[model samples]
Target chain A: MNTMEAMLASLPDQYRWAADLTSPSLRAATGALVCGMGGSGIAGDVAGDVAAGAPVFVRKGYGIPGWAERLRPLVVAVSYSGNTEETLSGVEAADRAGLAIAAVSSGGALSRLARDHGWPLVEVPGGLQPRAAFGYLTGAVMRILESAGLVGETGLVEAATVTDELLGADLDGPGRRLADDLAEGLAGRITLIVASGSAAAAAYRWKTQINENAKSPAFTTTIPETDHNEIVGWSTLGSAIRRTVGVVALRDTHEPPRVAARFEPTLGRLSEGASLVGEVWAQGEHPLARIASLCVIGDMVSLRLARNAAVDPVPVEAIEVLKRELGET
Target chain B: MNTMEAMLASLPDQYRWAADLTSPSLRAATGALVCGMGGSGIAGDVAGDVAAGAPVFVRKGYGIPGWAERLRPLVVAVSYSGNTEETLSGVEAADRAGLAIAAVSSGGALSRLARDHGWPLVEVPGGLQPRAAFGYLTGAVMRILESAGLVGETGLVEAATVTDELLGADLDGPGRRLADDLAEGLAGRITLIVASGSAAAAAYRWKTQINENAKSPAFTTTIPETDHNEIVGWSTLGSAIRRTVGVVALRDTHEPPRVAARFEPTLGRLSEGASLVGEVWAQGEHPLARIASLCVIGDMVSLRLARNAAVDPVPVEAIEVLKRELGET
Candidate 1:
């Protein structure tokens, strides 16, 4: 396996360990904020979902939002290498604001800051690229939020164990077999990912991965919501464009009954011209595991799709150029 | 002036009056949720800026996010005619979730539901198109959220009063005169709206107006977050795309100094070939006026831009056709 595949292969086990290892922080925080860049920011997004009551805001840039200054949030700065400039800038802003601050990093400037300032830190294992460390970062954030009392403990240990078992059981085996199916179904087509509830995040991730990894344009919209607006847009597309569209439904057990009821009918309506693919996530003992499993599966599918497209799964030249022009270097 | 112009003319006064009338409502809510369709959604976007301690989520579709379902939130559903199917669906969902729900409508299913269900309802006068009821919808949602104990009362009364005075204020009135200048700067460009802190809401409103009224493609992003990822994307754009971009910075006094400080330098560095326009919203007596004025001004500029684009200011044909094809009629 290539590096990404190797990382993917080990992800389920690593994520379970990470989830079990980290302790939840105390929840006495007045407010909460997340500071990270790129894939690390995805952890914050998941954290925001799980800790919805904590007013979690993701800091992707050097400057904090104006209102953040007055809120005096509990800041969690995340960096895979512990040295991202944007994340460090957020840490500095938190310091200036006198906000309670923490750090999640392997070892870098952020780690040093955490050590020197005596701020609580979650030490992730180094070696993997930032994207490859997604499982670790996301699990760590969940542990911290849970410990902080920002979210209820949802039997995460059991969930992680179940996820580990599922991964070892070759759940992705089907996904790989399905890859050729997807390529055949999606050839010369635009993919639209439709997800509901918590699945919206995963759907968005899939869209991004498809765009970056598969080097194809993809759009994503949440269920019920898209049933109203975006669904309308698809029906109006000329037959030529309509024939070039594919719909992928990412379903999880957590979806409400009403959402499931709406899903089939909606998909049936849209499937008139577009190809439809349904990928159901395996159930886990914990919501965390279930979420992680789907995410990993998505990453794998996106990568395989890239292979089918005869494109490199990693390098995003357009995004790189955009970043370079933005003077991120 | 056409009906839209006449309605726009009256907005400043209406906003000021509504601000005073709804101060208590604005003061009570812990946070705000703005629910509406199309232009009405713009109200929530503007309110997001002025409402302290309230993170506003604008719901433009049929159902709320699954995370929202768990919150059992206080949601203000705005539908000018009180009959928008999407808003009605959202209202029904919120009601079923036992959320604190309110309605802003002239008369229709929403008003009837509010009345029959004993839900709080703000009756905006009918006759005007939803797009033309910007001031009323904006004022009403803010007031309701405030009344429900979701946000603070600061600037509520003052903003309303100032908006009233400005209604009669000439188009060339000092701050309002920039309509022409902004239009000129934005001509033949994809206007990107940027704001931080309390101004972020206004920036979003500006973008929507540019999309719906200007009938052109536009985008909005908040500061700090955009600086990290989106900033990098700018550098990758070819010269043709870069020159076709324009930046509109929405400023308010309430922004943190650090956030305000990063504005100029970030824009200078990020917008290489783009023209930039700055619109500063004067802190009026009420937060309502402070937000409404920016919204109204943006609407005017967008309408002018639409004229320049040689597109009708109303009627989204593509969207309409899409809805029809989906059997939404």
Candidate 2:
């Protein structure tokens, strides 16, 4: 097995490690502002979809939204390396605005800043790729939210249990099969992942996984919204160009009836012009479980695609070069 | 000139028509929630970037966010035809939650709803593509904000004037040249539009324009965020796949210093593997003008590319079919 395969296999353990972790001092707030970018940032997306009672806003950019300054929502700053520049900027902005903050990172500038500012910090293990550290990051986020009284404890435990049970079962069969199916038509064709509601989060995860792990181009357009513009293009695509594209629909059992209704017709229209690789259904009852299952499948498919293409999925050398050139390294 | 060309040429008039209009009775609010889908939704994006005093939240999906229901921000519902399902759902949600709304549309279900509910309404001219009515939609939004005492009148007038002056000075030169350059290399390659800060709105505009007008696949990744993930993929792209992609950097003068700093190295890293079709700078001193300039240029580029490809830009048969299939028409 390759490095990514090992990392994927370790997901259950990673979740177990932080599953029961909690912070007593974290304060409850009306809403949450999660600050992180790329891998660490995705934790916010997952949390936003799963969390109950309070709304969570994910900030993938440099700072908190201007209105959040006055609203003073709890800021959850996540950076696996504890040194991501955008997350650091967001934390600083939150601090300057006097918003309460909880930091999640291994050990870097973020942890140091948290220590200096006396903010609550959840430290994960170091040395793994940031994306590989997703389980830990999300575990830390959910625990923080729980400690702060934002979400109920039952859902969190069920979600963790569901993820563990589903992923722990022999990982090779389904994922490898899906990857083979995808890789067969993915070459020389762009992939479009269609989804709606909370499932949109998984669609994005699929697209990014394909881009980073498989080293291919992928795009996502959500439903009802896509019905307005993107559907037009998909409907009118010429045969040659249409044949050069593939579609992956992420379906959720929990979607609003209206949202679900659009999917079939949308997929049918798209299939007329492009190839429909297949559909991936959301698994488990809890929101977190459903998101996790789809994300894991996508992650495995990306690794398999990388293996098939004869490329290593372990290193993101390009990101390292850009960071070094920017003098961040 | 084709229908799209004539519509593109009328942008100046669209802005001029709504320049002096303002509603006096609209109530003031802490922030604004602009809801719409497709072309109409983009007005919210542009306004969110340009509006002053209160921050604007653009909701592209159905319904208002749960938090917004309590926060009670001013809701601006925009649909060129006033019949878009998502926008209608958003307006209905806002209404049920007792949130104030101002509607922008030519004539359709939205106009009727607004009248029945006695909500404020701005009627834009009918018979043009929703994307083609961008100037009018934005103008209506600015006027609503002005009347609600959310933003100042001076900035609104200045924005309209800037859009008019720049777009009126013969639309043939810069945009045509850029389109010729882009179309030369865009045939078989996918286009990636890169942007940062508020200019990210313009970048998305460029992507959708290329998708709807040129009927091609295009993707957008914002700066700072891209530095963390996408840069890695672009940097490690294999030669054959690398040659099949093109990049367009949308540069803005208003980007934060740190955001501006990352553009060069990021572009440098991407250009190594992908063809950099060149950069487009955001123009005009006002925020609205800058966004308008970039959008108009992209609009022209999309139309030109369609002409070169021998495809009509006006009909969105796919969307109409989906709507009819869904029984909305």
Candidate 3:
């Protein structure tokens, strides 16, 4: 199997590890900041979404908000390879601020820093692209929150079971069918993913995955919010949108009726401006399962799109070039 | 002056009013959720950015998070015309939960509901489109917070003076000159606005204004964060970006050294793909002044682009039609 496929198959293992794991006592902190970058940061977004009853903020840049000091946040530094420069800077800043810290990574600079500082560190079974290993990173963050008593236990194990069922179902199943259908509509157009509630974070995941894996332009924004601003950008694009843009609405049971009501009006407004409008409904009993299922569907669509374009999805050559160039300078 | 121009000129008035306002004794509230829609909603974004000592959450849609009841946030409902249906739904939900509430609007259904419940209400100055009245809505929300003691005194009055200085300067001035330059290059291309720190909120404002006024496709995202994701989309587009996309990066001296470091690297990654990459610096010493300056610059750019496109900047036919359609159904 390819790396992405293998990493996805190992998701159940990550959930199993998280379910049995014990955590050290965290300090008296009212909130938590899950510090990461790129894929690691996206996982933090998912963790924050499912981290019930806790104020979880995802920090992606070196600049932490001023409120962090006053909240005395439990800082969760997450870097899959343990080498993300931004996360390391954040760890140091959090330490200087005297905030409690937790670290998650494979053995690398972050692990060394955590060891040096005696912070709680969880090691992932490494050797996958950071985005591909999102399940483990996300599960580790959520597990740490649960064990630390900051959040209630998540239905991660159940979610993993649903994922397994999805894997077995293949082309005729919900996940693959949804992927093939969306890839057809979104093949050559800029996709705008609209979503709300817990699924909002997952909407962003879909956008980034399309950009990286499908090699296309995509955008995502939460609703009721998008209703106010971006919906107007549609009219401004005029006729060009008919050929260049498509809409993907991510829906879940949790969307309030009033928010749902806005969708029909949005469709009327976007009718001629968009090439197509599509929907993806998250299917699961728990919010965690729903979120994971939606993410997996999007990942598959991105893969399907890559297949359509006859491009190898694994090679992120431009990113590699940027990294090499950045290192030299 | 037209409503938008009057409101823009009266930016000083809003600040002056906010500086003098005294808030009623709000209940012991720790954090706040500022609920708003469209133009009214962007105000909440600004309030959250500068509400130094407190965490402000901006809820755009009806599906408030499940944790909201547990958080018991001091809910601030903002809708400039006081008639936004979604904001009213949110207000009702917040009230049902027995959360403390504050309402800001110009006599509409929301004002009536706020009065009936004995909750705090701030009346916006009447007679303007909700978007045009953003300055008044923004100031009222900030003033409400100050009055409630949720946040400390903002240098609002001082910031107004800077607006006066900007208004007095001619075409050779900071706002107009920057606008002319940007509109020149961004005349017929899709603009992607990139920003970080306090300037991030302003970036969204710029994007929306361009969409609504200039009638174009535009996007905004914060930095370091954007570096991790959207930068990949640049290369993925291959050469299409060279013909279709222009990037506008909003800069502020307040950005950290590490974040500032990424700009050069971003330009390098974008060099081959983008038609043009431009940077506009925040103009004043205070954070508020700097943010407002960037916004004014963007507002002017949108106007200039509208003139170039031979489109009237005021009418929003699609939005009006959508509102009428939603009301009927």
Indicate which candidate wins on lDDT.
Answer: 2
Among the numbered candidates, top TM-score falls to: 2
Task: Indicate the worst ten consecutive residues by lDDT in candidate 1 chain A.
Answer: A228-237
**Candidates' TM-scores?**
0.71, 0.94, 0.92
DockQ of each: 0.15, 0.53, 0.51
If both were scored by TM-score, which would come out higher, candidate 1 or candidate 3? 3
lDDT (tens digit, per residue) of candidate 1 on A24-133: 45546655688886678778876775564455667666645555665566788889888776788888877987878877898988889988998888899899867678
Instruction: Order the candidate numbers by DockQ, best to worst.
Output: 2, 3, 1
> Per-residue error at B191 for model 1, in Å?
9.8
Which stretches in model 3 have alpha-carbon errors above 4 Å?
A: A20-30, A169-174, A320-329, B1-7, B20-29, B169-173
Residue-level lDDT of model 3, residues A92-160, one tens digit each, is 888998888999998799999888989988888888878877777888887778767767757788778
RMSD to native, candidate 2: 2.3
Question: Would candidate 1 be rated incorrect, acceptable, medium or high by CAPRI criteria?
Answer: incorrect
Question: In candidate 2, how many Å is residue B162 off?
Answer: 4.3
Comparing 1 with 2 on lDDT, the higher-scoring candidate is 2
Docking class of 3: medium
